[model samples]
Target chain A: MAIVTPGKRPGERVANSKVLGKRFTRAKKVGHASLMLTSLVDMFSIIVIFLLMNFSANGEILYMTKDIKLPSAQHGGQLERAPVISVSADSVTFDGKQIATTEDLQKGDVLNVPELEDVLREERRRYEQIHVNDPEHPFKGLVNVQADRKIPFKVIKRVMFSCNQSGFGNISFAALAKTAGEGKPLAAN
Target chain B: MAGAAAQPAGKGGKKALDAELNLVPFIDLLSCCIAFLLITAVWTQIAGLQVASSGGPPDQQQKLENTIDVKLMLTDKGYALTMAGANIDIPKISRDGAQNFDRKTLSEKLKTLKASLPEQGSITVQPEDAVAYEDLVNAVDTCMGEQLRNVTVAPMN
Candidate 1:
């Protein structure tokens, strides 16, 4: 037999039980309000791993200035960490310091550049000093050249000649890597 | 945690260790690491082509003299391939309206030269004043493609 209160009808008793059951279920759901941190952490882990792989594969990074635009080459190898000489259409800089203008560098038919030679000689001396203490770190006389694509080969030759004269015999030309099937010819300016 | 500590020991007398993990600081550290890695990532790859400017070791020079001296001169008209004693000229032929050296012919010629003189590893590339830098690099690329690694750029007067 259903026990009913004196003021309530039998139907009202059933309705009350149903309402209490719904409230119990709603109260049980309130405990499940947890943040899905595991999925977020999983996503971040993938991104971190991907970025780390790229960082490792990328060898020495060359910080290029705004004045130079390196030409694209299909056969360039990894760049070594060395002194950088940047040549643009208007000016030339060594280690980010402006040393001479394009006109001044190509002033005469003379192959030697005096100002660049002086700067490179100082660099060689500094390297030699560093190598005096550490025999393992001998001076390799390597230099990196970052020239604008529009610059003529004559100016490049002059710069290269100057580098040779300054005792930096090993020269490396900086270029952007070109992927296969790009089909776009390199800009000729 | 205080309420649990105040409770009478059930079963064994040992206190239960707190197992809740603090994720706020851990998430903060991960965020910082991700941001740093993203900021330091290198997008474009920079590469180099090595060339020796002048004098090398005596032994290396002796080895060089044993083989032919290949000189590739970039002229406005075409590429002049001079092999110390042999004279071979490849004129600039236009393909698709752009004046360019005949790369195929040059490559074939270089392959023949490489076959004849296997010890020759260097080639001197001299471009005229009017020649573009890209053209010079392209010529170098062709030379390198044919197994001539030691590419030296000569000064143009």
Candidate 2:
């Protein structure tokens, strides 16, 4: 058996004295701003899930520029740590160093780039000396080329020619990774 | 950061009991996680398409002999696939005269070529001076998707 007593609810309750009533009345609307954490938590959780999906452990990703917009590809391998040669409409740079100008390369009929070859040769030598005995990370002769999508193939041909000349025979073109099913499926015979 | 709420216990109740898991620390941790992931997230996955020789030291690439030289040539007009002294032209089909070569036809031709030469997995891409880099990349991508992994880019003479 329980005994019930008549009590004042929150709405029906009155302040004890004049000062208390004034204080309560003033604090009611001032401190009543409650945060809607449900929606905030929901949005943060969604963003966290999306970011986790796109997170990559490969820290040394390509240092891309606004000038070079890479082409998208469906089939490709993960980028290896190699010397990158970025070619834009204005100039050709290797490992952030300006090796040659695009206009000069286009004007000249020579396929081989002497300046770029020198730099790559030095890099290849250094790599060989460092990894001579270590079989784990042998010299793979890999190099990355980041070029603009709209640039002419003539500039790329020279860059590749120079890369091959400098013993970096394995040339990998940096491309934006695209989903597989975005394009129509073509049979691989 | 945890406490049980006092509620009337009943065998049959009008409202279903719902436990509100409102933790300030949990929200704080979630915010931290979201910040960390957002800061370190790689929005666009930049990958690599290997399109050249395994030859190293002196640059004298081995001539791919005893194999049909499957060369896909990209020109200003269209794409021309050359194999063993024969040229199969696959014209670009676009209303605005853009470089839109028929990928399906090219795939069929490559399938036929691959069936004939199963051992040869390498291809040489020859691009003209006026050809765009994106077009060349797309051509190489198609070849690689068709299991021709070893693609060597060469300047068209």
Candidate 3:
């Protein structure tokens, strides 16, 4: 009932062969594709190990503002986590909150600033309240101070005096650790 | 049919599946962890110089009272070494050129002081308003190098 044209059959065969050849080429390319995952995995493993070592040895992490630049010291132990009193060139801040300015602290030969005292008193009271139930852990009264290297010692002393009056007996000055031979003359002399 | 029979069933099939570990996601996670850890490593090196602003522990206070309290005043001239109880003063050695304190003389003096009073473990460094922080740190390092481990800072009014 159906009549097939000879010319049409040959053309159909040619098109089918072209499609089959294209499919074969694509299959070959895929077979040759290789992913070098072994080397990548090894490199990542080494990096992970190195990072973990550094993380474990890290001590107390203090959140210091950008305004203060801590002086470098060649000898000192790790810092302990405690309340921070930052003394920048322009302002004095307690835990990132500005309590007074350098001019206010150095004004009129004042050894202690009233505003800093009040803040430290409040901080002490809060700390006492939190540890009141734990008899074993009495209030250690340790404070960490981050003062800018440029700020005069006069401002720092007033802050320290305020902290002492507020019942903090132990004060720690935060400093950047100097690498060996970086500041050798200072230490040697 | 013959080729299918020739292929080992259990060992070869299991080996192919086991070799694939879906490492792309694992590698991505490891990379992120490494980056985060590397950033925080810098914070770990920051240290603290401890000072007893007020009275220390009872045992420490008793020991501290027996020993002499030495105070080093850093002025524009030089360092004024004073003994609280003995009432002794070491005259300031004027600055060498632009340098504030004669650190070499200061170190030698501190070394001599330590030799005489081996019991002395602490010294209070009081810097004037104009003294640079670097000079203060240098003074402190000198004190520490002389084995004065307990260094406290006070301001000279």
Top-scoring candidate (lDDT): 2
TM-score for model 3?
0.74
lDDT of 3 at A182: 76
What candidate 3 keeps of the native contacts, as a fraction, is: 0.62
Candidate 1 has an fnat equal to 0.62
Worst 10 residues of 2 chain A by lDDT: A4-13
lDDT of 3 by residue, B106-142 (tens): 7787888888888889888888887766567767766
In candidate 2 the C-alpha lDDT for residue A108 amounts to 69
Worst window of 10 by summed lDDT in candidate 1 chain A: A20-29
Residue B61 CA error for candidate 2 (Å)? 11
Tens-place lDDT digits, model 1, residues A1-189: 888456433454554696554443323346467789989888888888888888845445565768777767777788888989888888888888888899776566777778888999999999998789898888777999888877887778778888877878888888887764454653321
Quality class of the docking in candidate 3, CAPRI style: acceptable
Q: What is the lDDT of residue A68 in candidate 3?
A: 75
Name model 3 segments beyond 4 Å from true: A1-33, A56-60, A187-189, B1-29, B35-41, B54-60, B64-66, B83-97, B100-105
DockQ computed for model 3 against the true two-chain complex using alpha carbons: 0.38
- Which candidate number maximizes TM-score? 2
lDDT at A118, model 2 = 97
Per lDDT, what order, best first?
2, 1, 3
